[model samples]
Target chain A: SKSNEPPPAPPVVHYYMNNLTNTRTPIENSETVLILTPLAKFYQEYWDNLLKISYPHDLVSLGFIIPKTKEGNAAYSELQAQVTKTQSGPKTKRFASITILRQDTESPLQSQSEAERHKMENQKVRRAAMAKARNSLLFTTMGPTTSWVLWLDADIIEFPPTMIQDLAAYDVPIIAPNCFQRFYNEEEKKNDIRGYDFNNWIDSPTARDMASKMGKDDILLEGYAEMATYRSLMSKMYDPQADPGTKVKLDGVGGAALLVKAEVHRDGAMFPPFAFYHLIETEGFAKMANRLNWESFGLPNYLVYHYNE
Target chain B: SKSNEPPPAPPVVHYYMNNLTNTRTPIENSETVLILTPLAKFYQEYWDNLLKISYPHDLVSLGFIIPKTKEGNAAYSELQAQVTKTQSGPKTKRFASITILRQDTESPLQSQSEAERHKMENQKVRRAAMAKARNSLLFTTMGPTTSWVLWLDADIIEFPPTMIQDLAAYDVPIIAPNCFQRFYNEEEKKNDIRGYDFNNWIDSPTARDMASKMGKDDILLEGYAEMATYRSLMSKMYDPQADPGTKVKLDGVGGAALLVKAEVHRDGAMFPPFAFYHLIETEGFAKMANRLNWESFGLPNYLVYHYNE
Candidate 1:
């Protein structure tokens, strides 16, 4: 499809000054494409909190993946009951049908050689498994009318009633709220607030450099690169009581609490069941979203609290 | 192509944190795909300066587009001679075939209605035209072995002989050098160094918000949005005489000079002929590359300078 010839050179002039901004499009209310691919055991806490969200649930089309872990089938059975009880509403409600899927865990890992499995890092397998599970949740569950997808982890122990409304206020393509938990302070001897999750961070240049040297399956999970990474540059703000509006650029996203624009998935960004840019699962999705010019960020204030061991 | 069903619900947990870094695979002596599409009046300057590069010319597969403008045919004819003279080398060199192509410029503006043309912001048409021309250049000229494609505008008059090496040193997917010019003092001007390009920036939230609202044909060219943009955040380095190693993150790319890894192009990123997310042409290509997980940057110390009238 190319011309094979030595065409003559051209006389050139310096015509070079370029600038244009993208038009501003404002939306009063964007429909939710809520997706929950949780592997937690607390069905009641997750479901009850889902009802507590200040936003109208009728506008929300829900989906989740029942990963084929040991407790997966039992969790699916109970969740079905919960959905049946919760499904009925007035005629004005336009909620699309609910969706649920299961992991095809028929010894998929057996496909790998014994040697390969033995050498595989635990984190890598877990990431791949989770990524696969999340992929199942999205591809099998997403409805056409959805505009945004809020990813929620099952183990969230506490949160305000206004989380969905608060995160939507940022209005960026992808966003993660800080996940923290209260614990008996070993030092203070009292319950204290802590910014517990380290997954969402602003990476240092060294981490960026070290990334290329790692294997595709070797994901850069948080709490591991703390020495080299700034680990949530927003954390440097040093305020446990930070304002809700605060946000920062993110290198990775924790699955616990996230809000994603559905258009990202519609544009072909998915949780890679395998490594993508050395990241899998949620981080891989974040990478995929960033690559597509839909920027990702994390809120500094804790919008949702996670269960502590 | 996607499933739509309201299957049973699944219990989900906070299988929350995930991270992975892209591996940095270093390449040594990647082959060059040099391209320049010019209007042809400055043919002599373009040819001579090209011969001055330190990298082996024999290793380059040069290509260009001569539009159907007035001097376009004449420029193509002369470039054929220059290619012949400069093409000879030992067998060890890896030069691929040279290429030349043409643009259908017969009243390109004639297609636009007179009222529409009068109301049009010139940047929109320029960006669209340039994007189309560049796409044609790459689609028509690039060969299989090309690992890198260096886009050079005809107006660039000065650059390091090690220009390629310096840029490749960053080892990222996409990069651009700061373009500037030396202007003599008509009165108080003592050959002041003017940093010519302002498209590169660290985007603020307002600009990001404004992006989705803009039309596709609307291109943010340099100098036009100095007030709205965080213009050339790298230009604050305050180095009229800084070293070449200095660099910074870029939000937009200037057309005067740019270096791109070919795989980014091969992976479906190109100068989008139509508007893509409020950007078209070079900036759109940068956006596309970034979406595919390639980081783009700019060198602050002027690696190249453009010619003035």
Candidate 2:
């Protein structure tokens, strides 16, 4: 029961952290979104791209939680400097708020290196901690006036400037854009774009069968050759010629650039730290939303580039 | 002196005409825009396209003034019916307000036919009357909180759904996207897109020379064989490969879809009903803005389709 209690609303250390003018708009005219990010590390590109978003800054609230680790501490200091500068800026450029939160407990795994973090064995524990951090940020920063929640990964380097307005215009309950990255193609002698987010996918009979046989602690990880879920991955669906508004039904969702209606969250949809229907974290979030009758959607051609590293 | 008085605020006949829930957003959080359209006749396509704009409706206030004519009466009836239906609709779908005003005076030109209206001889009178109508709408409906003013022609049937947000993101004082139309090319035996608004152009030495020789009332009209301005038309600058944010300096602008910062209008930039710098109406407004040190910008590749008719 004590573990179930959400880490005491990780103190709202900063409110209106991005707003210098301190201008407040009523709920009717402003359709607002709270951007939730879980940071294990900070990249300047991520912050730059966030500021490049064309959505009215004053209407966008931000929530971020850094892990209680050395890298996260460094990220916290860097993020704090940017927030201070942006918070004192002009009226229209300022965001409604920036909520900085620290994870209640230390991350399960000690190493922050990519090779160790990306190991198939580490995913279950890594994501469970990530889900907790997300839950902490969501429960603490989401406010009464928030209309939408955008779960953005700190490593996402580029997205359409109008991504927020473009996604919100669809008026869907929950949606994610196709995440992509630029990688060097040795044979082609040039850089090429490829899908980066494997979490977005449609369920398959094989995955269902595999899930039924798994134990309570076992999780279904995507993009792993060993697991062989045989699911239809949303990442592979990107077509440049296809209309960006094209939508496909999805059973699993990637956390990168996910946009969701606030009502979906208020109605009790959240990231499950443990396995749910053989899925964990964001994928498990889709399961929870599905249980609540809210469908998960993916825009195959609406691409947001993630940092390749 | 009495004629200069603004037609007594045109009786705000309809306020919040589109907002059913009557929601209100604060000035700080909501960057507001007023969409002003002067209508002599209305097509269902116009109203439908207006509704299709993806801008947050609650932050968009609309102003429409139908001319005093037989066609105007029919448009008013049709527009009123649609407004009544939309005003009572769901909350987020409805606009903040739809202020519909009837022109204080009858239009100078009576013929609504394409052939009669497009005659080169009617250019001066036609544009002068249009200038008056625009002034009336702008002066009456623009409130203290309004941040931008979009001069949209009713017949502009298609545009990127996020046009408002896209245009506002530029943060320029005054800007207009290239207006184009689809036309059948007899030689090519296919429909092709062609520049439609010749009013958007760069000033030239030839145009200045031509203007100096003309009498005070002799207005310079673009797209005429006899009076060549030899200007670099913005409409001709459209290139599919260019970035959408590309902006070019201009001494003139078109009214099809002009976006202006509210401060420009508040600072006394207006449509000149009479010849001002050898231009009238929208182009004259650009001249006034230029005189006040606000540069005019045209997005050649950012095209919005005008009604072919």
Best by TM-score: 2
Residue B245, model 1, lDDT? 72
- Residue-wise C-alpha lDDT for candidate 2, range B258-285, written one tens digit per residue: 9887656644466767676678889988
At residue A187, give the lDDT of candidate 1. Answer: 88
Candidate whose lDDT is highest: 2
Worst 10 residues of 2 chain B by lDDT: B11-20
Scored by DockQ, the top model is 1
| Model 1 alpha-carbon drift over 4 Å, by segment | A1-30, A88-96, A106-120, A225-228, A233-238, B1-309
Weakest ten-residue segment in model 1 chain A by summed lDDT:
A14-23
**All candidates: TM-score:** 0.45, 0.47
TM-score of candidate 2 chain A against the true chain A: 0.90
Tens digits of per-residue lDDT for model 1 on A176-244?
887877678988788876766666777677667667788644556555534364454544444656565
DockQ of 1: 0.02
Model 1, B1-309: lDDT tens digits are 012221222222211111111113213333445555544344477667776766665456666655665565566667666665555544333244455544444425533332353343655675566666665456434433345678887668787767776777777777888887778968885777666655555556666666656663455444444426444454445375766577788866766778887655544456654455566677767775665567888888755776656
